[model samples]
Target: MKRLMKTTIAFILMLMLTVLPACTMSDSAKDLNSSAKNEVGKSGESITLRLTLWGAPNEISVYKKVIANFEAKNPNVKVELQSIPTDYDTKLTTMVAGNDEPDVAMMESGSIALPLAEEGKFLNLQTFLEKDPDLSLDSLVPNITYSSEVGNIIGIAPGPESYALFYNEDAFKDAGLTAPPSKVSEAWTWEEFVEVAKQLTLDNKGRNAADPEFDPKNIKQYGVNIGTFWGAYSNFIYSNGGDFISADGKTFALNQPEAVEALQKLADLVNVHHVAPSPVQAKNIPATNVALQTRKVAMVVDGQWNSSSLADTNTNFNVGVLPVMKEPVSTVVCGMFSIFKSTEHPEESWELVKALIDPEGSIDMLTYGTWMPSLKTWYTEDELVSKWTDNLKSRPSGYKDAVIDVMLNNSHQTPTGYVKNFNKIMDVVTPALDKVWLGQQTAQEAMDAIADKAQAQVKGRRDLE
Candidate 1:
């Protein structure tokens, strides 16, 4: 009898502990729903908040219309969009250090977003998220929610981004080859890509890279141009089953067999194959949009952001899915609007965050081909997808498959971006990698030289410690 009473009492206590909170949460969520429909401010009240972002003038022009629509939705709120053009990440650091950070700042996923969120500089979004039950992250691509979190969510993404092949159709035609595949299902293999690049590469004497007499120097056109930046190289690293960080996330993985092989391939493009311009010459090439369209380069590895510029210029180009190496994979980028912990109006700032991500609000940026909506409803609900994509002049041919389909199925998170103290780790590793880029040494030799020190920084960096 005593044992039975004790067991019954314990079970009752456990149920109270779990069930009571769930009931409370249900009520809280309901209350928040009610508040959302009502104006938080008094009738006709007004507030102004500074929103920081970085983009070219054309991007800014479109964002202004987005802001106007947001303002119309909440008549009392005025959002001033401030564009930070150069060294955007460093500028954001300065703002945080000076206590002059904007109420809502656009934070790109990866290293930049991670450190700040970990430091508690951004608001703890747990309560905000719990309260706003209507905010759906269901459609957010993989790694987005992870980037937004460091124990607690510090932000919510407005849209997601990924890399894809952007090729000049005229360049391909001139090379006597058809354009590369537009869909991921038909992506070119690394060997096929290199051969195509050779066809497009030409010298002043009109010799292609495939020609035995092709001049290595004084080349008039490169077959392909690959950026050394993270966004571009990462796709190669991942596709080859290599990564810069170890699986445990505590050490450098750049010296691994897979990574070493991948780096060698990148170096080979400039040094051995001569299909791409030299590292020095690459610095002088025009922007990807201009170089591809003007026939200075045949194909370029770049992000989806170039889509808008290409559309606006009416350039003769087509989207190509990323080339496959040992596997089919590519890196993705997601950008979010985060409220600072110092903001006087947390609720109002959240309102802006919503307006940035909501299906209705994000369509302007989405249709322009600069972003993929993070809302699942946008893709799953025809009424929603058509609402934004249809009648949008900026969307390119096969965008539905190349951008949307790939984003949903093919893209993966960047490893270096997620690892702690990654920026410091890269600082040690980049110079060593640069030697490979410049053809001073093979990738294996250069990375092996710096492997120990790079891992040291990853495990016990001074700044991050």
Candidate 2:
């Protein structure tokens, strides 16, 4: 059920763990870069570069100020900004088809960057990036920076990102248990995590899931929400030591024992253990902030982007690193600033891309917890980390350990599913998930039935090796 459809529930581009549509760069790195070239030095000529991105009006307003600041710093180069209010992919596709694409585009990470790069519609940025002294692409999250590539580096995003366990501290206090792990070393094993969750869940009759008399039907507070629409359940697949696709990007692993077991455990939370809400029952639950704030749920496994939503809640919640099954891990998701091949102002555009992704471009947004920095400096350099994570208005408790550490060390990008062929695979597998969620079959049973179709789709993809 991870990102099966076009409509996004929480964060629009939140469905994927990783994508690889573009070709890898050759070792010599000579032909990896496109013919496009501009000098390394700052441009002295007066010019304008058309920039395009999608966002709500307020986000656009915030970016407009960012653009204004960029323009002030580069007085000679002006920016013509275009905002796509809706159907960003459709509009972007249309623009590309019409040969009217923007010079620098804020492409949604998985969906747009990979396919467009595959089509050779974007310039290879490896050469230009090699000259940078101030910004090191190596310092960025490889899952994000490495997202767009076809024979060369073509895309880069400014932040490191990951999903985490957000739990109510007061609820943990009431449960008489220590809060979940803050650092990866202390992360819980699957059984330990489930035991803790069972303790936190309470029925209206004042019973927990551990009680044999506990009722699943009249539950008042659930221990966790697997984030039915937020793609949280998929992480269990990774945690259990399996993947949606193989390293060669040529096979699906949904039917593997590890993944099947992982899926069963997730389902058991609802169907068997009755510690978490059913996918259908999750509809009654409020947003992440409201659910945790109101104590309707004890914990939520969700993305870092959700902190902004929780800032107003008086829940006194704190974040914890994800639990380990076989190993500590997390699913990484972030968008990138990619350059369109049609852009005439490649040098000037690269400058803008760097400015936007760097901490200074949108420090306030990062500080507010909507995003985390992609630059290594944000994690390694104390002053840079403080610039984003140390703030009165933002920075939930234990965030440095939960969000920052996990992203830099433990996270991996979900395979983009053979050049956006994921939807095709999910189209066939989601029905199986629906049945499993409804208790029509066991996780292995559902996956076993779908194995032929999934492997067929995986092996049939033209994009994968």
Candidate 3:
């Protein structure tokens, strides 16, 4: 009996020792696994982020190269690039409505960015900028940076985009002119510009605007090709001391006398002066390529992106760039990349954005001539300016100065509210403006109709407040 009790006690003690040690080992393993997962979550050690943008084939190629380089340097984070089509706003709207928003997206200036920012779809970048002192806000051009501040900076301007006049040097010489004005500060007033354009306009018999036989009906070439796009038209309107919307953002001011005068002048170019292509003719050309390449028009106002198109073609004419309206006033279209509030990795998304707008990246874009650098310091520095001018052996005389003026002065933005509903209202205004251009309706009648309809739509939107 004594032997039996002793055996039982020994067995119980042995079992307790074995089980306790095994249970401790199991607990330790679980702790190690939990710690590793926490570290991964904190560091974003192995994660993929989605970036969305719209670009042409070459533009996408360039972006891909930049992304590859970024990925190599950032081993723990990977980026999947999704190339959205040019109709990005439509695509984005659908995606957002479906609750499948991209982690990051490139937004257009004026209407697209303002409305999206108001919807609270984008992450507030002010918080990130505040945390990173190395990301200098001062480096960006003041106006460009100011445009990005939708209720305090929802994004950063990734590229410096601006509008300038593109002129055909051969056409100028054909008109017996010395050269198109290059400096915006020294640019000709509207009257002076019209006079030069009139000289460039020719009839089949080679008669000029001053000649009585220079028949508008039998014209061989237009002196200018003013874009009929809403954004382009706004440049003219704003430069003439007119505005589409009031400063308070509540009312449409486009029916004012100044605004009417600006519209009349634009119409006169087609109807009275017979120097610019009619809106119908401009639309039929599809892109500006035919007008510029064939030298059918002497001058046209276009954005920096047109540089690539000009370079890609075999046209031998020297290209010159100037600011808007030949007046000191101009408007700039500044676009940026915004991270959505639903982004899974806000920190990583910002890092990618920083890489894209870094000084080195800015230099690459500037060298391409499709974009101006957004950095203020780079604009003043001789080295940066020389990159575009000194190397361009084909550049027309005074071309560099004109581009520089566009960079320095005459860069402004439409009021925030105007930008918010840009496309919606443009749809209304374009057809009405077209009617005026087609002679179906007078400028006053067309503008009055546009003002009434636009005001109603805008008022309804504001009432949602």
Candidate 4:
């Protein structure tokens, strides 16, 4: 009789524990729904939203100003900013695992956000995006969309950064060479670019790379210092009419002739041509602005965001389109802002997300050259383009053709946007690339050795979903 009573009591206690919180959650949800329908801040009921971001102190300061602007407009909404400067993905994942995710968060699309979206952890923002008069997928730059599933957008890049050639104007003048092309139509072919690079490369004795007296062992200044990693070289591969994976995404394609050739040229710039530094040599190289200001490198192939620092450091630099192997192409990429599905106040959270992505709300980022506008109208409309670039210290002359036009017409979204398990595939592929960059192996040899392993991890593109 006592055992039966204890069992009944234990079962009843278990039910109470489970059912009570659920009932409380339901009541809270109802309150949130009522608050949302009544137009959130209109009801005079204050709400706090948690937002996560990963950036340095300067970036955080900029974000705080933006957040303050958002708060000024909506007195009832208060935001708690959580800035994680390092190990962001690991910490964000831990928060999600503990069911303590922030209402809205910034994440690298291909690395963290898209993978989580695949597990239904993020809210499907399709309806919100479609209904919002101010935002639309159609209005965004082509190929920058982030969706693992068709017709569903879980997150989006607020702004994009694209690759361009940043050259020291004085260096060009000193070398007695014309500036690199600013227009896409006039972009240099790979061969033409290399010939120019050879002229610009100089040893301590003042002999250029093209001269017989030039000493690779005592290079005083490099002609170019193009990043040899996936972020930079992938654009070259695409320009060569090849890609890291096949169109169907089933096969690894880096071993193809065109892709191999592009990578080989990059390697030869160090090993044979001696116009650029090897990875070891680059370790001592400073940031783009510092490197150029000190004449450490005559030209740098880097992201547009470098314009901010170039301006800040007062470097006399000019922008140009990247040299093409076959086709003119630049890589456009940025992180994403997303809302977690676990939030009890999704509507309020969405309000914060909207403000975060709104161009006007973050105008400082655009004007200061840390980011480019993601909206098509910003690039197409002269008035809007002037708002960000005209009279700005960061945007030099030719920015319209070199950056805005190229971004609008000649950009390709980074492969991370559509390639599933891309990070994993790269794990198998990057070491092999390192060998090519270090001159330990030929591009063909390195890629061939990793072909089977990389393909095994491909799984396919996310669009297949």
| Highest-lDDT candidate | 4
The per-residue C-alpha lDDT of model 2 at residue 75 equals 84
RMSD of each: 9.4, 13.0, 9.0, 7.8
Q: What order do candidates take by lDDT, descending?
A: 4, 1, 2, 3
Q: What is the lDDT of candidate 4?
A: 0.86
Residue 434 displacement (Å), model 4: 1.4
lDDT of 2 by residue, 285-325 (tens): 99889999998899999888878778866778889988888
Tell me the RMSD of model 1 versus the true structure. Answer: 9.4
Model 3 scores worst on lDDT over the 10 consecutive residues at 456-465
User: Which ranges in model 1 have alpha carbons more than 4 Å from their true place?
Assistant: 1-48, 76-83, 86-95, 109-112, 146-151, 380-383, 386-394, 459-465
Output candidate 4 Cα RMSD: 7.8
Worst lDDT 10-window in candidate 2: 31-40
Q: List candidate 3 stretches off by more than 4 Å.
A: 1-44, 110-112, 145-150, 283-286, 316-327, 362-364, 393-397, 414-418, 459-465
Q: Write the per-residue lDDT of candidate 4 for residues 1-465, one digit (tens) a residue.
A: 447645755565556557676566556556545655475347546778899998766677778988998888888888999999889999999999888999899989768887898889888887887888877878888766678777777877777888999999999999899999999999999999999999999999999999998999999999999976688888898899888788887888889998999999999999999999999999988989999999999999999999989989868888988999999989888888888888877877777877777777678888888988778898888888889999886898868888899898888878888788889989998889888888999999999998998988887766664
Instruction: Report every candidate's CA lDDT.
Output: 0.76, 0.76, 0.68, 0.86
By TM-score, the best candidate is: 4
Model 4 stretches with alpha carbons more than 4 Å out: 1-36, 39-41
By the TM-score metric, which is better: model 1 or model 2?
2
